[model samples]
Target: MSWREEHRSNLELKMGKVVRLLGECEQQLIDETDPPTKSRLKSQISELKGQMRDCQGDLDSFGQEQVTQRNLALTMASVTYEDINFVITALLNQRMISIDGQDNFQPTNPEEKMYKNDLTHNIKFFLDMGLAKAGEVRHFVENNAKINFPDVPERLKASLNTEYIKLIRSGMRGDELFMHLYKFSSHNNPDPLRQAAGLAVLCYFFETCDVFEP
Candidate 1:
């Protein structure tokens, strides 16, 4: 399940517990004779109610945030090689990729290293040139951009097309393409979030193609 789903489920479970506790507190208040004991039970019931309200509020807020993100994701254009390359360039410019002596792209940090390893494994196993390369490119982008890697690829693909998949299969790869796209896209666009969202959309596309195993 996605993190959002898990979070909502947890909130629901907590709310259920709070309700049960509140019921017990009310029952205790009815059975108690001592003034102090009755006061304590009332306080406990009040606290449980407050906790329930807080949990409900958090659940509602999370739902609203999900809707907003979905709308933002939908506003993006279909993913293209240009978009993928743009994200890759942004990562490279940020110094997230390390150039090995053999000219291979390696990770420059612990987080990047993890993503790199994951991509390398997927490429080795999946053996789909378009998907593998695209996945690797997205791994770099998502790691550097600091966005939570999307759980549903289809959600990400809401704004992507399949044109870039064929291009990657036909031997389009590496930092050169990334740099070219970056220069073109960043020429007039100053917003980094826009670039980040593009990368995320590309990630969704690759994932839908079964390239991004993670």
Candidate 2:
């Protein structure tokens, strides 16, 4: 009838066609019979939902700040292969270092033994990575400032450095080379102080352990 009314009717017809097209698409997807394809589609839908939830959480926390977004990206980049390798070396092989006073530092119980072993493995990993050396271990025992551990915190570094000096001065000799590992392995020692002492010793061992043989 009227020009405006005709235009509105034409728009409604276009909207109806679009709705029909969407419904047809839904029906076609529903008719798919491949089990693997269906499983994949379901997995994709689940992932999208999880991602939507994460996006919603992020928006609530920081709300569209481009700088925050960039900071997160940078932080992710910082936690790469080298960082992971170093941390794993620290945690699993405590022998990568050498703490001082190994003679006075015996763990009195079985739990201490376990802790010592784990720390020893961590030390081995560090040595394998070339983060430490045997001569450095001996030097640290005589005077800690000689040995360098980049990832160790400053507060802990002083204590660890002291341990290295103590281990060598106390008598880490010959077959007793494994004394550091035995003292620090997670399975051997449970006392936090003892375990930590063991870790320092292991770092020295890793630094100095005979890499050529093993």
Candidate 3:
């Protein structure tokens, strides 16, 4: 099996053990009446809960990575409208677009046309031109993944749309815009898997496509 698969399997095993232990600890808490012993058990339970959460998070990340890798590989091998649709669907499901009362990273369209049209154009551009160089996709993914949008300066946020338009007009193409959107989405959602998936879709686009210029 691949390292990724093996890692996931190991995590699953570890999670199983932790879950079993947590159950035991809960039982102990119920059975024990001594104050000092109960306190110790409670502490252990809390620690176990934290561990479980960590394990779950790791598992989730692994799953997202797998999906992203698969889709990227497919896109690189075969550039097609269907693959593009897949990427779009993944982004939407991951909340890269807005929902009621929940802000996302979707750019404000100055034209005010259908949002999907803008997304489609951007995604197609990245697939066609953004990944022209070796390792470009990897670099883009690494850099953008590190961004936490909430920590950005308020001044920047206030003029994000204007700045984005300027950048687009000034030769900023597919990969760059995608990264911007991905970071914004991640900041709003605060879910690692969802963010990873969005990035993966963009990476897939970057990996595919024959056209290398805007």
Candidate 3 per-residue C-alpha lDDT over 1-214 given as tens digits, one digit per residue, 9 for 90 to 100: 9998678656655654564466456656767999999999999979977886676567668667534433332233232223333433333343121112222233333223213224443343222222221133333333444674332222222233333444566876544565675554233444443444334343333233211111
TM-score of each: 0.30, 0.21, 0.30
Clashing pairs in 1: 78-159, 79-160
Candidate number that wins on TM-score, 1 or 3: 3
Per-residue lDDT of 101-212 in model 2, one digit per residue for the tens? 3332322332243244333432332222122122222333444334555434332333434444455568663324444433433235444333333333444334332111
TM for candidate 3 is 0.30
Candidate order by lDDT, decreasing, is: 3, 1, 2
For candidate 2, the 10 contiguous residues with the lowest summed lDDT are 125-134
Candidate 1 accuracy as lDDT:
0.42
Cα-based RMSD of the predictions, in order? 20.0, 24.6, 17.7
